[model samples]
Target: MGFAGAMVVAMAVDALLGWPSKLFARIGHPVTWLGGLIAAIDAGWNRESDPPALRRAAGIAGALLVIALAVALGWLLQSLLPPSWIGIVLAGILAWPLVALRSLYDHVAAVANPLLGGDITAARAAVSRIVGRDPAALDEAGIARAAIESLAENASDGIVAPVFWGALFGLPGIFGYKAINTLDSMIGHRNERHEAFGWAAARIDDVANFVPARLTGFLFVLLARKRSEALSCMTRDARRHRSPNAGWPEAAMAGALGVRLSGPRIYHGSITDEPWLNGGARDPLAADIGEGLTVYRRAMLLLAGLLAILACA
Candidate 1:
């Protein structure tokens, strides 16, 4: 099937059926099982290699194997169940676990609530729930900036990227994307410990996200009018960020929201001087995070619309 058709099928299934049948709840659902299985494999296979090259190879091999397994298992499920509504219903239910809209909103809401309540301590704690940074020193603005940054960055990684892949290759592509993404999340760090060990996951994720991130920027521009500047900002600033891919969405979001993002952030007690994007606008505010949510919603709708058009065309 074409991209459009696959997306329609996937989204329709997700919207109507949602995730995880009670029947499978005892096993913690298929998505959880797949993630757990990959995590287990990574735990063992990752230890078998330590040199940068070996570790990188192990990570890639592990990612590919997990994807293959997901595909094989999906096929097995297809066969075990008859091709009536049961097969289609089961597929939709299982697929819902792969998407992450509800989870993302919940995480961001946790951070925003504390900020709205004027509790800096609680706000910082909430920020810590979503970010790995030291939150104690962050002021209201800093916390707002961090939460918005994650919302923008993850809109691509956690939401659009998976949907894009899933639309193209159905269960297998989504499964592969999630496997690589999970590996990246776990090991794709720049710290000394993960710099070598996670290099493969990091690089593969970079490539994997390269298109989706840029597309996210484009969709943002298409949705927000005043944010039209996002197109130019994305073109210019995306390449400037440390990660070859992440800056596209961050820069696009910064421009869309008319604020700066990603400059001089602290990680693991040390400070890394990162350049700012869209410095011409106001510092981001709690309200801008709301704007970010609107943008996220538009992007997802645009994604679904694009898929529908593709399916029909």
Candidate 2:
């Protein structure tokens, strides 16, 4: 068994078992641990009084340090483990937490379930856990759109990208990608606190996500009922999104579900007049969220099948 074999097992394990709550309570999460490290770096070096250039340099150093640490750990695991069934199983277990298919589905379902029950308040609260925007301000359609958008974007960031790297560079590759992603999440904001300090992490994350985002879009196109619309969204509207990589999957999802997304969202107290993807499409409903989950499930299955074929080949 090799990288592809290990990834297939890991993905299956994640989809079936996810992370156990008992285990999580005992040990927390790998991403959470990485976030702690990032926070420590910010506390130590990302000072408000520091010059922008110096802050940026410190951020880069911090990101590099984390990446090196993650890669070193991954390499050590691979080198120490013998090439046998035990090694493959150990590798899969280590990689399982990095892939987030089941978690994503569950979180999105939490929002959809409440909306389906006609509980707007619970729906709003559920959506708040996933998005950065003001959930309190969202109407039913807005909440549905936010959940679908998060599902689409995270399908790339949380699932496809990790598998892509794992297939190409084994455990080290996946761990390194996760480290970069965690750094970006912790410090990669456009606000006063992180704008300069997070520049490197943000750029690195963008580059890391570029190819995987497109792949996610393509997966959406395949799973979408309206294939042409999905393709059009990926080629046309994806470019209009604020983040270079996030737009691809969001556009594909919007087109796939035939719903408008990403226009005039409120963050904190300010309104961001963002461009809409699939602007002419219908407003999303709770039913559309269910539909999006169906498409997401199909896409994950397709990805798994593709990886299985690759592993055999």
Candidate 3:
């Protein structure tokens, strides 16, 4: 019953009016709530004193608990709605805060605007909010690359993936995905303490993002001005980047803009010697970030259009 249409509403609302500050001040975001839960579970279950095998098991149990709680809340909310057109609208409104469509665009634009003004200091500050790398080390070219890469990668995780699931499974889908994603972000790292314990969270995140990531890449390819190059680069270079999911969209963006991305970079004082996507291409300029935003908007439109078609069907 208009599942696709509900997603369309969620997209439209979020794009027009992002999560308002007043509302956020009053009630913290769903992710923050989930994050609190994850933190508690991590402190309690992910013990440094525990053996690695038992820590792994505890992580699994903790992950399951978080997922179950989110899924259950979503199910309960969905059950409260009457099954009608009104319910569809309500469903979309509830899912609105989950998608970060406008937030991603605005964040990348924040970098572009300052860089365009030739304020390297301001640009560096803007980009640092979004990327994990050391901003102080970045020149204009580095800032541009970081911002565009963030735009492309988060376009999948922040927008398309949630929309894909929400359209298919309503509240349960979006909520469950956010919970998984948040857990991964918080605990899924190869640090000494979390390497074994966070294994389950990392693996689950990978599996969840697999299809949405490719779909996001395809969307970029379909609408890119340099369509053929985008396709070729995505196919040839996606695997070259570090992440299985992030590389698809990031490579496609690199090809679409005719700019190289994902070469070596410093993260927290250490160099991550990542392979480049479209390595032969020139590095991105500040203006390329603006161009990347245009492409991003187009790809999102194409996604919304497809969902609209399905809704009419």
- Tens-digit lDDT string for candidate 1 (61-111): 876676677667655654565545444445544555666665666678778
Q: lDDT for every model? A: 0.74, 0.92, 0.93
TM-scores for all predictions: 0.85, 0.98, 0.98
Q: Ranking by lDDT, best first?
A: 3, 2, 1
Could you tell me the TM-score of candidate 1? 0.85
Global Cα lDDT for candidate 1: 0.74
Candidate 3: where are CA atoms >4 Å away? none
Top-scoring candidate (lDDT): 3
Report the lDDT tens digits of candidate 2 across residue range 182-233.
9999999888999999999999999999999999999999999988989987
Candidate 1 regions exceeding 4 Å error are 1-35, 47-51, 75-90
Error of 3 at 253 (Å): 0.5
Quick one: ranking by TM-score, best first? 3, 2, 1
State the lDDT of candidate 3 residue by residue for 1-313, as single tens digits: 5778889999999999989889889998888989999999999999899999999999999999999999899899999988998998998998999999999999999999999999999999999999999999999999999999999999999999999988899899988999989999999999998898899999999998999999999999998999999999999999987788999999999999999999999999999899999999999999999999999999999999999999889
Quickly count the clashes in candidate 3: 0
